[model samples]
Target: MSLRRFTDELWSDIEPIYAEILEHPFLRGLTDGSLPRTAFRHFVEQDSLYLRDYARALALCGARAPETESVQAFLSDAAGAIAAEQEMLAGFGEELGEEPLSQEVLPTTRAYTSYLLAAAYGGSYAEAVAAVLPCYWIYARVGEQLLAKSSPDPLYARWIAVYGDESFQEIVRRVVALTDELAEQVSPAERQRMRERFTVASRYEWMFWNAAWIGERWPV
Candidate 1:
């Protein structure tokens, strides 16, 4: 029921996918703020799209989630996350004086969203929990780091506010704990793979943001 245990289990499920994305140098630059503004903004737009899809998946899962369920309850809160993402995105978009993004979702964003949807529709309650944990785990890590220090840029302050805040951490902690319970039944090998995916997903988050903001323009 502990947070570490939950994240550990979730990690087992998604590590390989996470690792591949993390290896990108361009993604690193984006997270660190070395990238250009346009690219970062684009990343934000794309992320908004993904968040919306994730929310949809969560909503669908809720209808099927168990009545006395801990994992389902955790996911139930997740259904509201897209609104949070949109609020953060709006603040940043306004600061840049750009028009708001359209409803269009990017292909990469769609792929990740689809993955979560598939998990929600078909994975066991525990397995479904494992499949979705990465979204929370990496946000907790990044939000911790970004919020601890003053942001070097203004746009990033909102990122700090949304991701690095206390509330988001609490959400991550709860989910990790819930998922860790499921992970206990999962094999160590599966958990290891999930960890790899967790890391890669983290990196992809960076790339996703970068692709939106500064994109391939950064020495990629």
Candidate 2:
């Protein structure tokens, strides 16, 4: 599908980051079932934490949105994020072991969610949308790519299926469409801010997976 000019522009800015993400060791391991269980567990744990805050940011965006449609879209997305996290985590109970996975917020996860919340709270609605877009967009894109090669590991394959499915892609398309709608109305400066927010979030997407591969923890 041909993207709107603004959406195209945003993707152009993140092409490099997205490429790096595709080549990340963590994703490579996921494809081959070679990822250490510990690392995957760490990723899941941090992801659970990330989803909680991510929902909050989405809610903020919903609350700040000018249109009822946009408000509904974001609020629905917020609910979906929470539900998806619960479902994903529940399926991993055995893989994560009977012991409760550590709920500690890894440094990268904290930084990423903090940036998202900050944008949702302080920036314009368009900027907030841009801030959260990468999670939806990158995951859908990565999911599709991974699906083409799908993982040998059932767990990894299941996870990939969730994002790669048509339903999830449709959800992402709705957000991208909203972005294009918002972009068409914004001033050049606001559009530039939106671009910046998208770029920053895209970079975080790479850092997030890389952190998981490295078993990131608070240094202090």
Candidate number of the best TM-score: 2
What C-alpha lDDT values do all the predictions have? 0.61, 0.91
TM for every model, in the order presented, reads 0.73, 0.96
What's the true lDDT of residue 79 in model 2?
A: 97
lDDT of predicted model 1: 0.61
What's the CA RMSD for each of the models?
Answer: 4.9, 1.5
Per-residue CA lDDT of model 2 for 32-137, tens digit only, reads: 9898888889888889899999999999999998899888988999999899789767888567799987778889999999999999988998999999999999
Of the candidates shown, which would achieve the greatest lDDT relative to the real structure?
A: 2
| Candidate 2: Cα lDDT at 80 | 93
For model 1, give the RMSD to the true fold.
4.9
Clashes of each: 29, 0
